[model samples]
Target: MRDCNIIKDLLPLYKEDLLSNESKTFVEEHLKTCPECENLLNEEIEIESKNTKPLDFVERRIKKETRYFTLAVLALIGSILIFIISYLNTPRHIEYDKDLYKVYRNDKIYTVEFADKVSGIDYTDTEDAIYLDAYSTKYDEIFNKRRLRKSLTFRKENLKTVLYQNHESMPNMVIGSGEIHQTLLPRLFLGFYARLSIIGFIGLTLILFLIEKFRKKAISLPIKTLLIGAPLSLFLGIIAIKGFNTATYYPVTDFKYIVLLSLGIYLFFIFISIFKEQKRM
Candidate 1:
């Protein structure tokens, strides 16, 4: 009876063809002797066959089409959103033009002028120095150039040694080269955080997978399935935003891309889950 129970417990994986070859042979041998379990498996197979007949095929075709169309639309939407977000998030050096830029301070609030076409702005703040750059998509620059006045201000304490860096390239224009005190990386950036997230999730997943494969019983079917799908989805989400790039000038907007891409991946996984047979715990 104990042997019968273990064999019966393994029947789900057996039906799914998920058991190892030795396990498969063991189950087959037991089924030859156990008429009750064999009858139950035969009934299940009959029901599965009925669900896959001609009418079922038509239903499945419709589902297949729906899944394909849904995934395609999602991919298209995710791509478009990532492009727009990245464009808006990217910064272009205003090039420190003396005429286009003006800096003035009143009551300890420092303000810098910008063109109205600049839809967004990026800055790096240090204990003493501050950097500023203008942001707009390439398309926005070409088609939406209406140079109306715009201004960004900094509080007195946060102001010192202001510069307009032309990216990581040329020398920064010293707008107000005050007494230097400290230097810092940009506060707003993708930096190494996104990269760490991708690597961490994949690494943890691989560890869990290895444990499951060799340890014989640490995780269940649901956990294994999630280990396969969710980590890949998250990895894709990060890639869709950063694409192996180490940094972005704007982490907030990059986060939006991750969210949008993850949505598409989630939708995809929902449909793909149909093919992964879930076994009892």
Candidate 2:
């Protein structure tokens, strides 16, 4: 039998099928008679098999990361689309036709009768409460009826409940109420933020992209954080815009749900990104 040293040296090439035909024949013949050499070969095979398990695990991890990145990209796109839709769909201010709304004073209660003939107007949905004001100065009539609705800011006690006629057509509308002191949506501290929320979002995303570009190391964490922060920023901006004091009323109560919806989408993306990041680690 050949020395074990020679067989051990040839074992690696034999395992890989790289050995010459004559050399392979010699190694097989030697192994048939040598128990120690056969055991050595078996151990090598086991070691290689063990090593392949980790490689398989690494491959799975890579696949998972790719999937997560794909989903994150999709989420990012969806968020931008939602922001645009919210901005366009948001009601700028409450408007009504002055002629259609006739004020009649009753005992203790004031009744405002709205004309059923009023049509072709896009009115925002009403909140639980709305601003009501009695304007003595007549507004210059325009083709747009929305400009005719007046707004006022005052304490709740100063507001009077004005009953409406053809209430079904008006149906929970905030306009035509005598006093404009009614609350629409909860006030926000950052009301100015709403005015420029979309611009702010765009700036923020651009800054994050630039930061990722300059950083030598991976910026996946920061990028992910930015992605998660975008919707929140937009939501706050919308609330700020709605809550800020203005001559004409911007309805906060009606559009506030969009803010919640934006936040929900952001949270969903954040959790998914975090889960993917943790699994990768």
Candidate 3:
């Protein structure tokens, strides 16, 4: 006869039909000869039958929730990456070399210089033009680092003619004297929209994380929070766009694209989370 302790330990496995065939045979044979063991096995089987469905259902739910949690994490990471790239690509400002341009006049042949200090400059002859415009090397370097290609546009004040710069590269530092602006680059832009985008990204992330943490409490709650996150992101994006429109530094076009990209990333995360939730359900 098998030991009672050993048989009792195997009773739960036998009740779930999880024991190997040899083990099942041993348990069955032992049960037949042992009345006490037989009663214990029967009781275990009855108890498992009563609670098995509920227990299985709970197990499956936990597994599904864990999967959804992983998906949420991936979605958040993706959105953050999108936001960063968009910000980097956005044109913050134009950089120029202030000391890079000079003009020399010789009766008929006026000499212009941007020798080696900048990429290039384009000029438009205008009436009442008293000065040559130039920028410094630091200006060009700053722009190069920011990823915005720079060029100069010369507009004649008297002639009312505007020249669009088409220089292939920064002009060499020029030798000559002209009235100059202290700096070609604007010092600060008061970037409203860019700030908004950052705030919105951070806020959305926090909200999503909190909602996901307690999602198991009520399935509908997380879904509702997701819905809120998307719209709030869009609303903030729009506000940021408005701020961009008013700001002098970043162009309106850049603001629009940045907002659109941020919105796309935010929506993508929310939709994916919702889709995974539905699948698990």
Question: Please, what is the whole-model Cα lDDT of each candidate in the order they appear?
Answer: 0.64, 0.53, 0.52
What ordering of candidates by lDDT runs from best to worst?
1, 2, 3
Error of 2 at 88 (Å): 4.1
Q: Per-residue lDDT for 20-59 in model 2, tens only?
A: 9999999999999899999999999999998777677788
Residue 212, candidate 2: how far off, in angstroms? Answer: 33
- Per residue, candidate 3 scores C-alpha lDDT tens digits across 1-281 of 44777889998888779999999998898888899999877787787788765778778888877777676676766777766555544433223345444555554444454545443332323352222332223434445544333343332322232212212232222332344222222113335444554676577667666876878454464465464565456545544434434433223444565466656566555756656665657
Model 2, CA-based lDDT: 0.53
Pairs in clash, predicted candidate 2? 96-149, 131-180, 132-179, 132-180, 133-180, 191-240, 194-237
Task: Report how far off residue 228 is in candidate 2 (Å).
Answer: 13
For each candidate, give its TM-score against the true structure.
0.48, 0.41, 0.43
- Candidate 1 residue runs with Cα over 4 Å from true position: 1-100, 104-111, 115-117, 123-126, 153-161, 169-182, 187-245, 258-281
- Strongest candidate by TM-score: 1
lDDT of 1 by residue, 61-108 (tens): 777766655655664566566556555544443544556567777887
lDDT, residue 76, model 2: 63
Candidate 1 residue pairs in clash (backbone atoms < 3 Å) = none
